[model samples]
Target: SGTAVLTPREPGGLPHGLRAAIALRAAAAVQDEELMAHYRARLEACPGGVSFATFAVPGTMPEDTRLAAILRHADLLTVEPRGATRDDIEGLKAADVTEPDIVRLAELCAFLAYQARLLMGLRLLRNA
Candidate 1:
């Protein structure tokens, strides 16, 4: 089964639509076409319809500390998890993100990293 992080453990803390949008953006970053399209549609059909085009451009994300924390954590986790520190965790806390929510967000990003690796491997095998 796919890692279904669309539904956050604490719904009120993080809405499903927002989670889906973030996941979609992460998928796009990794060039997972199918995953991106799936979540893109979900975001487009969300209650008020979220704009995810900016997701592809991290520099364009709103200047919200929470969002910045999430993106920073996602980047660090996927690119250089060994460099993560307590400050990283504290940053999310300073942004008002609950401890459990931070854990949930990390897990989601980890799953995305795994998905990206899987896609890359499959492509390489196909080419080989």
Candidate 2:
């Protein structure tokens, strides 16, 4: 399911490269090096994925307004999801992000968070 999220059959407005970059960003936010490497590999496999590579770094923002909006929303969802508001959606819309793409972004972020937590739990158990 996570792989599907990253590389959907019909990726809509979000391409595979962008999806990998977003997933990489979320993984990086949690400081999960292994997960980061996983996403990095996926990103490398994607055509033109390197253009979206900046997003993998937590603080790096894009010059493109639409991409900047996406980075902001991805950061919010990854770092502090509880604080997300409708205004964030409005911001994305203002940047020309379509409604379906917004939903796709949310799903990607949510799945990465879940994957991060699962990885953390497994690490803790292994050391226990």
What TM-score goes with each of the models? 0.76, 0.95
Off by over 4 Å in 2: none
Model 2 lDDT vs. the true structure? 0.91
Best by TM-score: 2
Report the poorest 10 consecutive residues by lDDT, candidate 1. Answer: 51-60
Candidate 1, 5-60: lDDT as tens digits: 65644554556666666667677666678778877887777664464435534334
* Alpha-carbon local distance difference test for all models: 0.70, 0.91
Per the 3 Å backbone cut-off, how many clashing residue pairs does candidate 1 have?
0
Evaluated at residue 9, the lDDT of candidate 1 is 49
* Deviation (Å) of 103 in candidate 1: 0.6
Error of 1 at 72 (Å): 2.4
TM-score of 1: 0.76
Best by lDDT: 2
